[model samples]
Target: MDDHVSQAVGRPDLVRLDERLICLRFETMKVLSADAAVAHLLSTGAVRRGDTLLDSSSGIYAYALALACHRHGLRCHIVGSTTVDAAVRTQLAVLGAHLEQMPPSADLKLDQNRRVARIRALLAQDPRLHWMRQYHDEVHHLGYRSVARTVAAELGNQALTLVGGVGSGASTGALAGYLRRDAPGTRLVGVQPFGSVTFGSEHVSDPEIIIAGIGSSIPFGNVVHSRYDVVHWTGFAAALSGSVDLLRRHAVFAGLSTGAAYLAARWERRRDPGRTVVVIAADTGHRYVDTVFARHDEALPIESLAPHEVTGTDGPALPWSRTEWAGAPAPPAARVSPEDTVAPVTR
Candidate 1:
C-alpha cells in the first residue's frame, strides 16, 4: 500500500484550453518537491527523528513541508508570509506544524526579509534545527525531474514551450533542465511580477501587487538565468485580468500565478499557432477567492500584445520585458557568513 503523502503529489491534469495552449495544473506540485527533499535528507542521514525542519514560505511550500514532516515523524516549523490566508493557517494547525507569521509589510520583499531574520534567530537558538533552504538549495531542484519526465512522455518529440512563474527557480529551472535532455528543442519562458528583483525589473515595492508564490525582491540563487528563453513581467492588473479570464473562459479556477502563466501561454500560442505551449498552474483558486474572484470586476481591460523576438538576457524594452539570458550564470546564494553580525529579532 502506497500510503505515503508524496504518492498524493504530481500527475496533474493537463487540460487543453486552446488549440495550441494546455494548462498543466500542479495544485500539489510543491508536495512532490517538499517530500523529495525531506526523503533525501532522511536517506542521507542529514536529519534524524525529532529534528525540527525549518524554512520560510509564502504558503504552498509551508503546507508541503508540514505534510512531509508529519509523514517522517519530524517536527516542522515555518516562517510564513504576512499574506498567508486563513485556509493555510488552519491546515498548518491540523498538521501540527508551528507557524510564525511575519507582520504585514508594504511588499513581498520586506515580508521575506523579516521571515529570513526570524529564521536566522531560531537557527541560532537551536543548532539542531535543519534549515531547508528551498530558495537556494540544489536538492529542491531534484523534485521536478519526475515532472519533466511526465511532460516528455506526454508530448513526445513535439516542439514544446514551457511557461511558469520564476519564484525559487526550482520548478521551472529544474523542469527546463530535464526537458533539455529529453527534448533539446524545448523553449522555456519565465514569468515575473513588475516589481520583482528576480528578472531585473523595477526594484520599487508595489503594495498593489497581490501575486504570490512567485517572484522575489532578494536574489534567488536557484534561478538559472540561462534556462529561460524569455521572461515576462506581468503587473497586478494584467495578472488579475488573466485570472478572471481563466475562470470565465475555461472554468479553471486557479491562483494569480497560474493566471499570469495562462496569459503568457495564450500569447505564445497566438504568436506561433504551430507549437505546443504548456503553462504550469501552481495552485488552485480556493485561497484566492477574496482577492482574485471577488474583485474580478475591478481588473483593468487587458490588451494582448504581439509577441516579439527576444535578443538578449537584459530583456526586451520596457512594459513586458522578454529577453534571452545569453548563458548568464545564476547569482551567488544568500547565506549567513562569519562576518555577518546582524542582531536577532525577539518579536
Candidate 2:
C-alpha cells in the first residue's frame, strides 16, 4: 500500500494499444516529479516541513505539487496560469494550496511570462518560500528513474521509441535519459504545440489553444535539445482529431497533449515497425471535457492527417509538421547563456 494518494496517482498504467504501440497513461503525471523534488529538498536541507513551496503551473503541476506538499507536511503556493480551470482550482483549495490566478489572456505566452514574474515577486517578498522551478530545475528529472525501469522491464532489450510532449522536458527527457543508460539506442520523439518557443515554433501561432502543460512560451532550462531524435509541432485541430480517434478506437480518454503524442506515435510506429513506440498520456480528459471532447464532431479523421516533413525550424508551421531534430542543439532564437539558467532555491 502507498503512504499517500500522490504515490498511487504517480504510478502509470502501461496499456498496449497494439502490437508495436503502448499508451503510458497517468492520473497526474507530475506527481512523480513533485514527490521526488520535495523529498530531495528536505534531504538536502533546502526546505523543511511546513515551508511554503512556490511555483507556477497551468493546472497539472499545481495539483501535483499540492499533493506532494500535503504528503510531505509542507505548504504549497501556486501562481496559476490562465488555463487553470475551475476543477483544478477547487482541488487546489481543498488540498490547502494557495492559488493566485492570472487574468484572462488570449496569448498563453503572456500568461506564462506574467506567472513567472509573479513567482519572482513572491520569492523576493518571502524568504521562507522555496520556489520549485518546475520548468528549469534538474531535480524534477529524479522521479522518472523508476518509470524507466518499469518500461525497460516490460519491453526487454528491443529498440524503443518514446513519444511525448517536451513540456519542461522532465517527463520525456528524464525518462529517455534513464532508459538510455541501459538501451543507449532508444529514440526520443518530442511533441510540441504551435507557438512554443521551446522548439522554435513561436513564429506561427495555433488558431486554437496552445494545448497547456505540453509546450512552453519560454526556454525551460531542463530541456536538453540533444535528447530528441525527432520533433513534431502539432496544432490544436490535429490534436483534437487524434484525441477523438484515440477514444473511439482505443478507449484511452486523454488530454490534448496525449492526442498529439498519439498522432506522432502512430506515424512513428508505421515508419519503423520493428521498434516499439510508447505514447505518454500525461493526464486524463476530465478538464478537456468542454474544450476538447465536446467538439468531437469537428474532429478530422486521423487517417487523413499526416505531418508535413521539414528539414528546419524556419519552415512554415503547418497544422502538423515533423522535423528530424537528431540530437541537434537548441535553435538560436531559444538559446540561453549559462548565467541565464534559473538556479534551485536553497536556504
Alpha carbon lDDT of each predicted model: 0.78, 0.92
- In model 1, which runs have C-alpha deviations exceeding 4 angstroms? 204-207, 299-319, 329-347
Worst 10 residues of 2 by lDDT: 336-345
Model 1, TM vs. native: 0.89
lDDT by residue (tens digit), candidate 2, 1-347:
98899999999999999999999999989999999999999999999997999999999999999999999999999999988899999999999999999999998889988998898888778767888989788999999999999999998998999999999999999999999999999999999998888888999888877888888888788899999999999999999999999999999999999999999999999999999999999999998899899999999998999999998686847699999999999987677666446664567
Collision pairs in model 1: 313-324
- lDDT tens digits, residues 1-347, model 1? 56875566544778888886888897767888888889998988888877889999999999999989989899999999998779889999999999999988866778988988898888889877888888877789888888888887877888899999988889988888999996888888888876666766644344477467778877766778878877777766677788888888899988888888877888776767778999999888888788778999976544654334455434443234455554555434322243332222211
Per-prediction tally of clashes: 1, 0
Clashing pairs in 2: none
**Highest-scoring model, lDDT:** 2
Please give each candidate's TM-score. Answer: 0.89, 0.98
